[model samples]
Target: MPHLNGVTVHPDCRHFRGDIPCRPNKEYGYQCQDCPVYAPTQQRILIIKLGAIGDVIRTTPLLRRLRQEYPNARITWLTLTPAILPQSGGWIDEVLKLELTSVLHLQQREFDLLFNLDKDKEACALLGSIRAHQKFGYQLHPQYGVAWPVGELANHKYLTGVFDELSQQNQKPYVQEIFELCGYEFQHEEYVFDTHDDKGYDWSQLPQGRPRIGLNTGCGDRWTTRLWSDEKWITLINQLQQAGYAPVLLGGEAEAERNQRLHAATGAAYLGTFPLPQFINLMHQMDGIVTQVTMAMHISIALRKPTILMNNIFNPYEFDLYGRGQIVQPDKQCVCFYRGSCKLGPTSCMEDLSAEKVFEAVRVSVPLA
Candidate 1:
């Protein structure tokens, strides 16, 4: 008798597959539910997607597909941040914070399958070291030179990132590309909001009125070229108020001062700021989101709220809004496509976008009621 996960693997069982725990061989009349390895040696799955919040949130759709593929498996996730994905939700059994010790400890375990979708060097390097019966997505070279896709299905995604021309030419949506890398069909899968981040609030009390629209001002620090100017936001807010919609300012502490200025300038309610969880909940109170591409945009889409998304740096085709929103780009063509930095110096391409374009888009996307 050989033991794995402290369960005996019967020598006579036909489900023995080299070095792995034995499974039930129905043809041999050996049922796994009746066997010693049933409980302790059940399928174990691991997922590694560490974050910048928005990426982690967008990646939540995989939980559904992974569960569909491995119903019996108890899934464990490794992430840099905690609580972005559900640990209490029925789908995920555990979430291990990414640390050296945690990685080394996880390395000791045997998994039936593993999925690593993060393009980070750290994640790719770890994926290369992990032991799994099967692995999908990118892997760092053994010498840790660079990350590359582990499967041919991921080749397109890999090539797109490796070559700027390919990225510009690629027409596949970001979500679809990621799903293909995992050998899973996209099927128009949507993200699940199991994040325990909700602090909850009374929606009736928070500036209730016709067509409450959130003006998300910040777009993170990585892509400066992607951000629309504060002048543009102020102009849009002023226009929105005149158009009979209550525009509320939305952003982290980074935009607190800017929100104050916008609020004072336009009387657009500065509903004030909250932590990430509370902010997300506040976003739920809004009827529509008018935002530059950011984490709020991801939340809005996840909640299925209609939006007028502004995009300039990235290609419009990269975003799949699931028909719940419309993308409004500047009148002028962007010189910085996929490049986080601007090529036009002080005169940004997003400056070409007018308040009328966004206002009209918002009106059409979520008509004021």
Candidate 2:
């Protein structure tokens, strides 16, 4: 009998890189496949999702499913926002940031399966060049050719971005479609938001006996029209206070100045900016969150906080709030779906979606019981 059990230890060894061995320390003083003292490698899987932060957070529904399907697989996730890795608990064994060194390291080894969800050219190109036993999601752009979404699951996601009509007609929420890409059922899968941060927030400073509502000021630069006018936010702030809710201001460095103005104008508690981890911890205090289709909205949904989503340009159906929140849209039918700017010019569709309607959505009796 061989010195080993003749069983491949791919799930317990360090050198095993799919079929390519990366032996180091001269442990066996020979190639791994030829060695008798081989320790098997854990089932290796790689998940690639570079960020806009929101996308990074939402992609986590795959974690529970991936764990169920490949229980012993040592998973490695690649992303730009390294902060989220800790938040994922130990679901992922390794967190590789997008960089030249990380790229080279990935290319050096082969994965049992590599799932690249990013549509960005760089990610697709890397997916094309990497040596994986199997790849799902988008793949490389052939020489001078455009990158293509690989499977039937990605076809709808791919076309939605390529054409106007497809996106308008797309009824699938991003989470459901992405789950399908990984060969899993939607079944109301939720996002994982537990970070390593154990910081505690003092909610004592907030006004008593009032619904603590968060008003996120910025909608990000991608879609300027997605943002309600400053006057509109101010209007909502006044309305929120009148309705006996304590409106707290939430935003990033970009919105600090804007939030400050809103804060001063409305006398709302301005919880100044903190790091992402601390910020996430602070969000727990909110009874509800009001924002456009932004990262704050994703965070609130993950926390299962009552979120009042303000949508104008994108399909409201694309968001799966898990039955925890209400989606408020403009009374006007969006003419420019998935578009950055509106065809209606100065008269934005949002103007018709009045502050009163959004306020109604924000005050939903209580946070879903």
Candidate 3:
């Protein structure tokens, strides 16, 4: 572990000074500020996390607990603009988009503490400007800024476990942990979307009666991890419709061509023509979701709606933290862990994942039948 020039790890930092505020207030049922777990000092803190959608979702509990720990203190989160504010809901008091070059100017306003959820070199360098009383994250890369070597992160451990280790000096805020760290329970509430009413959606055009199920055929940027085949998707859509489900297709503009192909192939309802928010609106109206390890999965988790995650490039062990779904892994024992591309062309993990198997998992999760 590297060490920051002037920073030291406070091994004896305790949690919960027991200054909890009243529960069920006018704003939040329980205002996080009243919790005694926050530090006794009034300090301005900043949390940094920049990654894919799911990684950001896993950090919610940490942010919530931090707020509870220091209700009187100011907490600002550093992340992409898209992942902040409107999408963030009240997780952090403020969000500072990570624009290092531009933030160089704001370095004049110092921070009392800096928390790093990601360890990119560029991001760490930017933290050098802010005068943080306490700096937390992986040790800087050799010649960078801070040098505090946190422990190695295990791939097998859930997302919560990895973050728990980073904040171990404080408290593990996961709701499912053995010890109640923050003295407050973490609840997975429905994703609160503030619709500005500036969008248009044709809800009346959607078929009525049967449960709505969203089918996702595309994976993330990485194609090797996708386990579902187009043919299988077509088969699944047919099976779902026959089994009394109103299957709807969901994806981004990047999926336009694939969505068109799938629509032509299976004749299922394609809602990709609408804008992104409109697509989200449709997702919100749906009864359930079926997808791979993509952003849609995170939305479904926040929705607390029953979901079925098809493990494509990764396994259930990689993303089992945000529960509320059945993870469908590959049947082939040949490649246990996701090995880049299959030695024999496209791996069967995703392609071989049968619609029948998926439908079974769906039935078990949502009980469509």
lDDT of 3 by residue, 1-369 (tens): 222464322211222212342222333543234433323336677766666655565555565566567765656677764442344344455566767644764477677767665656555665555667766554355554643333333111223443533333323323222112222344532333334234556588676888888876666665445646677888898898889888888887767788788889777788665554666677777788898877777667655667898875453544443556688866764353444566666545577778898898777777754
lDDT (0 to 1) per candidate:
0.79, 0.79, 0.60
Query: Model 1: residues >4 Å from true position, as ranges?
Result: 1-42, 195-198, 202-205
Q: What tens digits encode model 2's per-residue C-alpha lDDT throughout 1-369? A: 123576434335544454454454245455545466554535779999996899988998888888778776878889999786553355777788999999998898888988989888888988888888888888765765676888786777778778878877889899888887766788876787773246665657766677788888788888877878778888888988887788899888999999998888889898789888777766777888898899998888888888889998888878988877689888878887777788878667887788888888876734332
Judge candidate 3 at residue 364 and give its lDDT.
77
Range of the 10 consecutive residues with the lowest summed lDDT in candidate 2? 1-10
Q: What TM-score does model 1 achieve against the real structure?
A: 0.86
lDDT of candidate 1 over 303-361, digit per residue (tens) = 77897899998868888889987999988889887667877687668889888899998
TM-score (all chains, Cα) for each model: 0.86, 0.86, 0.72
Clashes of each: 0, 11, 16
Output the better candidate (1/3) by lDDT.
Answer: 1
Error of 2 at 124 (Å): 1.2
- Candidate 2 Cα lDDT to native: 0.79
